[model samples]
Target: MKKELSAIDAKYEAQKIAFGPMYFQAVVALRELGILQFISNNRKGVSIETIIEKTEVSEYGVTLLLEAAEVLGVVEIEDEIVKITKVGFFLLKDEMTRVNINFMNDVCYLGAKSMTESIKNGKPEGLKVLGDWPTIYEGLSILPEPAKTSWFEFDHYYSDNAFPEALKIVFRKNPKMIFDVGGNTGKWSFACCKHDPNVNIKILDLPVQLKVAKANATERDLLDRIDFHPINLLDRSQEIPQGADVIWMSQFLDCFSKEQIIQILENACNASSENTTLYILEPFFDNQDYPAAHHSLVATSLYFTIMANGNSKMYRVEVMKDLAREAGFEIVETYPLIGDSYHTILECRKRA
Candidate 1:
């Protein structure tokens, strides 16, 4: 009798394993409901008849889709009336919306469909899907109106949170001058001036982003204290203004390869004096073999590589120290700040 019971359990497990394909069908059904809310604004919950009339799909197909969405808890349906759930409504809200959904639908979703091929080939197919556009920024430039806006809005949201925390970690003491390398929109520099009334801030970035940053600084009453410098990081021969006590490189290094990073560091070293501090802040990935590092590191690294053409692989603290040493400075200290993110404040003293 016990043996027969064990066989029944094994059959149940097999059935459960066979249900894996249902997962993607469920995702598609939920996406349909999200689209419905996006279109209708969730005013009167979209019924099967309404969906059939509005979408390319038929009434029978609408019913099947709604049934799947109901199981996924994206919507509630009773007496042939359908309504978006709280979860569904929140998902449609401005802050919480899946703004990337359209981008996914147009570009990434198709690439995801070929994820199996990517795994087999050991290289992503996304770049090929975005042919002739050498970078993600270049590809985004060609996208139609709302898609480009949505992508940048998402970028702004992340920078908004990251810049403030990075400022706190780096600008603990008020300094006379700060050089904000690659400072987009002057958010970090503005925050610094607001925190320390006596501090003067300089922002360096592309002319386009700097124009926006200048406008923001003017609006914030920081135009006098904050200055914008349009400079390319690749061009090292251009003179970097001297005598800045703090040089900030926030979320900038990951955009370059190690060799390029070394070149940038070398230039920065030449610009600094004995009392200068170089503050580098980025999302840290522990490169050690220890199982103790946070699980988010792996996911963060892969997403940057595939989507943004970034490499977030962990670099040893010793490597940074060695770079500083080669550049004719001694690393005074390193500090971690604000959650698990590593904000290395490397204070380098110029060799006499």
Candidate 2:
């Protein structure tokens, strides 16, 4: 898989990698200082003088960022006038891009600096930046301000859009009981309650997260239909509750190491009847058609390595398929691109 690049372009790309962090900060500075917004506001290119004056940024700051932006292709400059480029527009207006940027800036930026140490130690060394937690999930309920919001927004944006289609697939067989492993915020369970009046969802997650989900269910008057089961997936002694028509794990398994994934799946299998179906919804990086989506997943895999958990990652479709198979389940069906989302849902059942 050789990349096609001219000698000059190859050297330039190497330089871009060398100054990657600095360039990232330049983008942040431009966005935060309102330079990008100001230029975008005025469709016609604005003079350097106008940018400094209108953005209220110091001339030194304005000139420095503008020059960097020009080279970064975030903006184009001609005759001392600065204008937003297509890349800049996406930075400013694309929901996915904005969410990724904010998530990185607020939750991952500082911590990401410690990724090397995290890899070396086989632990989330970066977790210290947020708090003294063993994993990010432990502190989700108590994360300070923007970090908490950024984490959930990043989490939901990837999976929630696939909920409608996921609902159709899960309830099609008229499942009466669903076990939502890692049912953060009880979102999928709430969706299930609404979709099938009689369906009961038993949420399996940490107590801290379940507290928030339980509160949400109570507020929605669906508490009666959803039950909370506090069990840490890392604790192998805890058995998943039995008698489920369907076992649902959405964007969940990627949070654990391969060995841990198999352990958890064993728990699910022990709890499941032969007729039960297991639905796993994950956005496998290599399974995607779009390069952007693939890149995002790879970046997220690094985030998991440095921030979420040390050994987990956004596994490839084949990797997950292998994990499922190793755990005594076969992927019976696959529903891809659910609702035009990046996710691929694997419908599994016990191997015969």
Candidate 3:
């Protein structure tokens, strides 16, 4: 039932795959040299000679990079003048593209070389490029400068913009105490305290991350409203604290395997009273409406396998719902793809 590709089309596809790395590096070079921005500003196209004059790189390097970018549809050349194409404009200016590019180049590209071995070994073999930690989260605070910046930028770009919208939903019931599980960097906890003067937050996370989160919260004088509970979620014996009105996990569970997630959810249940509500925010790959969004999530799963954690991924919504059900929770409401954000918030409660 599949349509066969024409010989020419097949060859084109094959060449794209074979030359992907070269094309990616060419775009990186073009962007790095300021050539893309230069051509973009020109609009009417600028002479290749002018680009060579403007950048420190050799004329040979400029020509080669631009020519390759042309083939990649990132630029165009006519009458000795080069112009930034639509693709090039996105590459240069789009926030999503910029984050993705930096994340790929600085964080994942080199590490991805060990992906095959990581898959075969069921471990983060590629993570050796970053550190010796079993997972990326443990080494997050110490990852080399720009790579660390790129990694957090990529992570926050997807999660932070959705906070205001999510806050409205989270605080709809006027919960007095919110237990923010896997509360990295304290961004959510800070937002919660600022949202409601009467509200307090307890952040549960690794000691290293909690230290940074506490410092960030303290800098804003939010430490009084925020509490830190340093505990490893992997320690099956350690449990989430009780007496919270709402339990929150935002962009967190994807960092864990299914079994670990189930255990965590069960711990949440143990910490929850019958009246307590649990909120889970995640970007489920299959729940994405846009092909581009789905593509990015699928690619992110590979990052989990090769560098983040050997067992986690951007999961399907149904799979997560099933796990929650297995852990004695029932979905009371579902907010899918909230406000231009690729995240879903599942409002769940302990099943009676």
CA lDDT of each candidate? 0.62, 0.91, 0.91
Clashing pairs in 3: none
lDDT of 2 by residue, 305-350 (tens): 8888899999888889899999999999999888979999999998
lDDT of 1 by residue, 1-352 (tens): 5555588889977875576346335545556544445334645665566666766666776777677657656678877778877655654553624543444444444445444554455444454555444335435545455545765664555345555556665666667899999787576787788778889989987676787788888888788899888886766775567788988877666656566677777777788887788876654455323333334344333434544444334455566667667766676666554433333445555555
Query: What is residue 117's positional error in candidate 1, in angstroms?
Result: 13
User: CA lDDT of 147 in candidate 2?
Assistant: 92
Model 2 alpha-carbon miss at residue 171, Å: 1.1
lDDT of 3 at 34: 81
Clashes, model 2: 0
lDDT of candidate 3 over 27-93, digit per residue (tens): 8888887878888999988998988887767889988998898888888899889988899889988
- Measured with C-alpha atoms, the lDDT of residue 103 in candidate 3 is 95
Give the backbone clash total of model 1.
0
Model 1 stretches astray by more than 4 angstroms: 1-32, 35-147, 156-159, 162-165, 287-331, 337-352
Task: Show model 2 residue runs off by greater than 4 Å.
Answer: 1-4
Please estimate how well model 2 matches the true structure, expressed as its whole-model Cα lDDT. Answer: 0.91
Quote the positional error of residue 333 for candidate 2 in Å.
Answer: 0.4
For all predicted structures, in order, the TM-scores are 0.63, 0.97, 0.97
